[model samples]
Target: MQDLKGKVILISGASSGIGRATAELLASKGAKIIVNFRSNEESATEVVYHIKEMGGEAIAIKADVTIKEEVNAMVEHAINSLGKIDVLVNNAAGGIRQSTFIDASEDLWEETYKLNITSVLLCSQAVLKHMIPKGKGKIINISSTAARIGGAGESIHYAATKGALNTMTIGMSRELIEHGIIVNGVAPGVVETPFHEKFAPNDDRLTRMSASIPIKRIAKPIEIAECIAFLASESSNYILGEIINVSGGR
Candidate 1:
């Protein structure tokens, strides 16, 4: 395990799913966790409580990362409460509904971009202000395999936003690496999370999706969290601007 003692890590949308798992795993490695949740205060509290119960340090903060002002405030709170942020996990994102280009609405497109693409930009910019001064930090984005293979009939808008994010990850890394900040991303395949419950509600459909993967099984939240933790640690210092695929060979 990576020794992250004294490190301060901020994870957005950490109330549950991959974000929550990342927070828990990092806390176990001795990192001070700033759990950012938009609306699930109770779930966020539970995450912090569990971390504390394990003798780890954690605090939950509420913020809508899509808003610039809120993003700035969240970063400020992390710095003030934990001294400084050493790692930022941009895990706050959503795909409200699926629609094809022919049937997609303007509002859906706008909302998808705001949540998946704009939020990443806003959060990274806000945190970079603090990380730049220190001349060192880590930014790990949660991308998706859909970015490569367009979601097509599923969620084309969501796929487009993630594609933009994947490109931004590379661009941001090149822009920030000279300053000692490493930017990378993880593209997870079909994982068993609330995302599937919301997006693919049909059990049979989900089963077919899993069967299509080479592994023939959906990933656990902890599996993706482990990849995020690796990218956040010093072990990935030499791995700048790359997005690792945690997909089950989909």
Candidate 2:
């Protein structure tokens, strides 16, 4: 509906969940998609195959977003394969392993920062070179409500990294607006993604947690994808430096 046709877009962590949903939705609207995955080559290819089945253009590239060199190379591949990236969805993240502060090791905190915060910075920086020259672009970072409402007994380090990301979004938006690049963020709350099945395996606790939300349900992956799509579109031209909460009233 937003006429993303012919636009080139890159999505990290696109093997499954919200990233995968975003890829499918954007591809449906005719954007040339670059699916970035870390280790899930089969799942990544499946996403690409589905996009192509719908007559959409897409390619899957494996890259560890947390690593600067890999992220930079992925950006290059996306640009070379798709021409130029008009929209960059910084959806790559890796802080789902929840651990208490005292229990969290230095390595855990370090890894959280590298994946959740640093990756966003590197990916955005890589894309900005091309984006600025073109004089228009959109960058959407996927954050979490945990960033604001701190997950209890969970990884405080994870929440801290997300908060840092939100801050970076605000700062980057201020600096890049003059360059015609809009930077924004989406903070999702309790989205029902594959991460949950692995992280919260206790059915009883998971059910109780789901019921605790004001909406009494977890968000669908597609819902978050929809918001990402809107932010990446021209419809959000006037919205800048904003972090839209997709938390279902949480």
Best by lDDT: 1
Instruction: Give lDDT tens digits, candidate 1, residues 1-250.
Output: 4788899999999999999999999999999999999999999999999999999999999999999999999889888888999999999888879887889999999999999988998999999998898899999999999899997347888889989999999999999998889999999988888987888889888888988899999999999999998988888789988989998999
Which residue runs does candidate 2 get wrong by more than 4 Å?
Answer: none
lDDT of 2 by residue, 1-250 (tens): 4778998999999999999999999999889999999999999999999999999999999999878899889998888887899999999886758788888888898988999988998999999999999899999999988889876447688889989999999999999999999999999988778876766767876788778788888899999999998998888899999999998788
Lowest summed lDDT window (length 10), candidate 2: 149-158
Residue pairs in collision within model 2: none
Estimated TM-score per prediction?
0.98, 0.97
**TM-score (C-alpha, index-matched) for candidate 2:** 0.97
Tell me the lDDT of model 2 at 111: 88
lDDT of each: 0.92, 0.90
- Find the 10 residues in a row with the least total lDDT in model 1: 150-159
